[model samples]
Target: MPLAALVLLLLTGTLVPINRKFRETPGGIPVFVASNGLHTDVVVPTQDARTGLDWRPLLTASGQPARPAAYPFVAFGWGNAGFYRSSRGGHTPGVGTTLRAALPSPTLLHVSWCAGPPQPGTRVAALRISAAQYEALAATIRASFQADSVGRFVPAVMLGYTAQDHFFEARGRYHVLRTCNDWTNRILRRAGLRAALKAPLAGSVLYQVQHVPKTRNH
Candidate 1:
């Protein structure tokens, strides 16, 4: 019975479009969703002068320098900490680690410095949303960061690095029902953009974003 139910959930989640309206934000802020085949990230401007979200503090806390002038965008992603911290040295986690992550485990927040907006391709999708939507999304992302009493982001033990990317402690639990892709989808929804209701896989989330018109007008 459990196996059957699991299969049903996957089937339904994979086939259905969570939000098919393709609604456009009225004068929305431009944001980008980036994917590297297996994982996805939400990219936003480093400092929204209007919203007053200076991401420099978060970057500094993670031991990353402030965003360079050429790279004005910051990318954020959430995932199981064990999978992220242990999947180093080209070593895949065993069944134990995988099961722990699949059943509500601690999570990590990944922040990266981006050169600019995501380009339309199999690996990236872009969307433009209103300032209101952007604020809500920013709040949601901010709430995910685990901070100290002084409100500085708590850096996670070093797992690995990729160019100008770093990871930090993140709030919330990660499970099969709320994977990294699901996190991205939720952030997009907070920004009033169309996204899959339950995107367990990166491809599932990217598939929905890919269908939307890539032009900024939308």
Candidate 2:
């Protein structure tokens, strides 16, 4: 089974759907790539198909009454701290912000909880991976966060951009030349899946996984 994780690249709104063979595996659990035109996130089940991992502990709201399992999927992405935090409330960063993000800035891990399975289209695609592969991918995502002595992920002081998303401190620097897609591609390759050799744009990642057959879970 698996648990999941992402980065923001404020590039163009191009969505490429090229068929890539190294993107998925047959008869494996389903994961998804969710995009908002410019940036992309890797979405996974709250608890994997085998129930081998319960992500609730990591994403639990400290004082909320609702359980973490309420979310069907969790989309993870990474981005510059300023770009992520300031880009909230439908606000676009200014040239100053973009320039700062272009530098070696602190990073944050973005997590969005989905109510259901993602619908595949130009903006979304399914990628099937074996249980072992799922675990490896999840492990890389989990490692991005800064855990507390209590062992839970430490969320930013600010509220999520929306009701269903939150930002947490992460362990990378966001370079203007390196898009979030590069980070995700590394995760895919780490899991023994095929990914673009150079994924510096959101389209680079989406293009590779677009043709993967939709799994039953999707």
Cα lDDT, model 2, residue 102: 65
Pairs clashing in candidate 1?
Answer: 28-129, 28-130, 29-129
Per-residue accuracy of model 1 over 1-218 as CA lDDT, tens digit each: 49888767765675566557765564566678888767789999987776677788766865655656677888999999887776776577678888888788899999888777777777887777667778888989989999889888888887446767888889999988888888998988766677876687888887787777545446
Q: lDDT of candidate 1 vs native?
A: 0.79
Clashes of each: 3, 6
TM-score of each: 0.85, 0.82
* Local distance difference test values of all predictions, in order: 0.79, 0.72
Candidate 2: which pairs clash? Answer: 5-76, 6-76, 6-77, 6-78, 7-77, 7-78
Candidate 2 lDDT at 57 equals 65
Error of 2 at 194 (Å): 2.0
| Residue range 107-190, candidate 2, lDDT tens digits | 888888888879988888777787888999899999988887866787877677777877787887888556677777667767
